[model samples]
Target: MHGPVSTAWSLVALCAATGAYCLLRMRSGVEEQRRAAGGEALMGFGMAVMAVPAAVYAPPRWAWPVYAAVFGAAALRALWSARAGAHHLHHAVGAAAMVYMSVAMAAAPTAHHAHGAPGVPPVTGALLVYFMGYVLLSGARLVPAAVPAAGTGSGGARARWGDRPELARACRLSMGIGMVAMLLAM
Candidate 1:
């Protein structure tokens, strides 16, 4: 695989790891009330995994249906949860990004002759954008917490939210760096 693809894969791996960490951090009550966080993280991980095959092989035309279904389902489910503005928006945007990537991956077989082709598929760029957005938003969510003494209100709230503010910030940055790597690869 090329450098961009490798980078993208690395980002996906990091994102997945962060997602797993989030899942582990969840409390029983929080996990039950807002399951979407874990689910979204898992989906992010899955999307990252999906990137692997597309990165290495010229995906067959037939893979289009599966790609669409998987991403579409994840997006729809995310939007349906409507957990919070940030969470919902993130999921919705991610789903749309996945749609773009799916189409790009589906067209990989004809990439050689396609107009505006890059060494990596355009979808790879889309995926990078999506994951990057995920990283940014997720990280932004942590910023209020990372800042010490921003006010006790949110800081106190972060305790109930799952994971420390500092750790959450680290996760977001890590995810963002991963997305950057993926984008670089592309």
Candidate 2:
């Protein structure tokens, strides 16, 4: 995303860390979580790369189109997966958002970061709204369910780090927030 150098680097760190966590999450025993984590890892790393400070290292122009192509393929894959389950639909949307950002960057690579851009694009606004809502929803889901404790016994050991659904939800929340930041900068 186009922004101050500090902001860019901050985004880079956040996204890269999220990506790394997603990679670890692929170790989850659940087939669905493992499958989802792989794609999310791609997104996290891709966002990190895109958030790089252009002032420090501007990519060649072709990079943007390549990004678009990659995320486009991701969107297709997510769409296919969505037929089996609804969570993949969110992945499809996220991938499509990445494609949109890539095209916008390609259109005016330097201008986006410059101070004198016009109003926010309509599509950007829509995307921002979607991601913001996702962040909120993901956060809400992170709270433990209200089921009564079973006889106050140690219910069960927490899931291992890689197997924790709460952590996965947190990951999605962080990415959703990052997407909002990236879109605002756009």
Candidate 3:
């Protein structure tokens, strides 16, 4: 029988779907924005793919390097772009978290446990933390909706942001649940 942890993996998959859908829905006239949207969508897909092996077995030592390269590139891009003050805060933090997790995963050895090792595998725990941070930043995208003034007939503002807040919320919840599962697995 499937354990509770498996359910969490399902949540992660759901989050990936929602995140990808949201990114696709956003309008991106600028080249950078377009790239960001595409990258975010790819991250969502990657997260889903990662969940499969994560759900089944502890991530192998090699997997960490792969994840590191992928997320490290993204973090560098986001940080470099941020120099121009073009990227959003969420993107910056998200990339930073990814970099941190990648490093942590890469540093994790895949052998006998250490004396002070976390209950969950180091790489798995790091992955969980990274994803949890992503979920938080992703959820932050919805904060603007909390202001009633912003909601007041500001069709233009709403249009500028693309998909509705409900959609963003759905994505956030999905990521949150997914992270929870990842943490449980760890």
Q: What's the candidate order when arranged by decreasing TM-score?
A: 2, 1, 3
Residue-pair clashes per candidate: 5, 0, 0
Worst 10 residues of 1 by lDDT: 25-34
lDDT of 3: 0.58
lDDT of each candidate versus the true structure: 0.60, 0.91, 0.58
Give me the displacement of residue 81 in model 2, in angstroms. Answer: 0.3
User: Candidate 2 clashing pairs?
Assistant: none
TM per candidate comes to 0.62, 0.89, 0.59
Error of 1 at 42 (Å): 2.3
Candidate 1 residue runs with Cα over 4 Å from true position: 1-9, 31-33, 53-61, 116-162, 165-173, 176-186
How many steric overlaps does candidate 1 have? 5
C-alpha lDDT of residue 173 in model 3: 53
In the range 1-186, model 3's lDDT, one tens digit per residue, is 014655646755675786667577556555565565665665566556556654476766787677767877777777777776654444555555555555555654543255674476665566577667766766776567554654477564444454444564555456555545645543
- Distance from true position, residue 113, model 1, in Å? 1.1
Could you give me the TM-score of model 2 versus the true structure?
0.89
